[model samples]
Target chain A: MKRALTKRIVIDGVLTAMALAIWVVEAQIPLPLPVPGIKLGLANVVTLFAMFALGPLDAGVILLVRIGLGSVFGGGLTAFLFSLAGGALCYLLCLLLRLVVKDKQIWVLGALGAIAHNAAQIGVAIALTRTTGLVVYLPVLVAAGVITGTLTGLAAQASYLALKRTTLLSRLKGGASLPKEPDDVAGEEDETEKKNQK
Target chain B: MKTWVWVVIVAVILAVSLTVGVVLLTRQPQGNVAYVYVDGELVYQVDLSKVDQPYLYTVNTPYGTNVLEIAKDSIRIADADCPHKECVEQGRLKGSPLVCLPHRLVVKIAEDDADSVSR
Candidate 1:
């Protein structure tokens, strides 16, 4: 039992590091769009992957650590608040989404999570600045979120599939320690069988 | 649900948001008067049309400093001390209001009548 706990902690740490690295690197790339709060959100790919490979609890831990450290390294207090709001919303959405979404459809979680994240950030921005004029950016942000979210979602789905082919995925699942709820685990075996057949 | 159902739903959302975004982005501002607010309080109002000479307007808030470039018939963030500098990258004010989220500073072009009514 102790060994499983250690393994889970180690895996979470590694995923957190990967997420932070992606966040820092992505910040350096200047997006052509002049709008604030718009980016590829590539780091979310790691979170999405973790959510499926491990579980929501592990994914939440990785996301929180990444956002906390990412803010310290790049953005400061304001960024921290915005990220907290956005990340929390995104995490909750994915938690609920995990039930219905098939492993192959991880991109759906990614896309919807990105939209929820962006919308939450906009809500924070509006509340902070106390400016209703900022609403003008909503449609643009939603459109951008969908496109970027889909791309990141596809990336996460591909990564999950590639990893599933190896023994690593099973090991990580074991390391997660907590048994998944029966409902959550339902259809998973069938999905794997379908994939194996293909 | 089938994967195709998810795909179609996302596609429709993408289509609608893109259409609405384009329309909003391309729409012209209603007036030439620019209102600058710091921390939700109105601080400065400049009529872009009346500016014969371009000048820099600096806003020093508790969050940070943002410098606005007010030119003939247009305004933009010339400089800002914020981390991302997204407001500066926003370029000249068009339909969307320029926002410096970190600094809680907003520069928006509003109709003269609306400005008077609010005051």
Candidate 2:
């Protein structure tokens, strides 16, 4: 019991590290928005992946670590405050949305997370700017969020699937491979996917 | 996948249409008016609608302070004992005056339809 819990703690720590690394890379890209508060929210894919690969608790930790490290690397005090407010709200929204979706198709949840993150950031910007005109940009930002989130979700889903095919995910899920093969799960997924393809 | 494509297409269309609408709706940009107050009294006013070409002018606030002007319409702080330069960005009345909020200084364009926001 203690051993399994320790393994989870370690895996979660590694996942958080991976999330921060991805965030650092994405920060280099300078995608401008018409308004001040919108961005692609690329790091969210890592959170969605972590949520499925591990659990929501692990995902939340990864998000906080990435946000903290990302802000420290690029932004100053004011940016940190804004990111904290926005990132916390985004994570909470994602957690709430996660209940509806199964682990297989978590991208929809990712889309919602992306939109929520932008909304939270815009809310913080409005508070600081005290300008209602800035609110007009929210719809456009939400629209942008949907695209980026979907892409991130697609990437995450692909990675999750690929990892599952190997012995790695099986070992992670259970200490040892079960007597009977768990190939049926993948087979079932493929059958449904084929129908969708048609 | 079909739904996703439609979503992206709609987002693109909406963003482009809204931006174009804002552009079409905006009237030609115009300069601002300059008002001066002294001893808590209305001392003078300058309607810059007729003023053309780049110019700057210096004026005093109620606090007996002199602000600087760079050109016909550009202004800056020649000198200000005020702790914050929030007003410094307000430079010249190309549109608005140097606004010192703590000092209650408003250097802004007075729109013709200031009452009506909708075009």
List the global CA lDDT of all models.
0.83, 0.57
Residue-level lDDT tens digits of model 1 in A1-198: 786887678778877887888889887877776567676677888899889888888999999999999998978888888888888999999999989999889999888898888888888899999997777777778888888888888877887887788655786677544545533433453354224322
Write down the TM-score of model 1's second chain: 0.92
Model 1 regions more than 4 Å off: A175-198, B114-119
lDDT per residue for candidate 2 within A1-198, as digits (tens), equals: 565566566666666666666666765554543244345676676677777666678788887877788777865444566567767876787677667555555667666667777778767655643433345556666766667776787677766666667665655555444424446644543343233212
Return the lDDT, model 1, position A181: 54
Candidate 2 structure quality by residue, lDDT tens digits, B5-29:
5456545745664565354324332
Off by over 4 Å in 2: A173-198, B1-119
Every candidate's DockQ is 0.70, 0.07
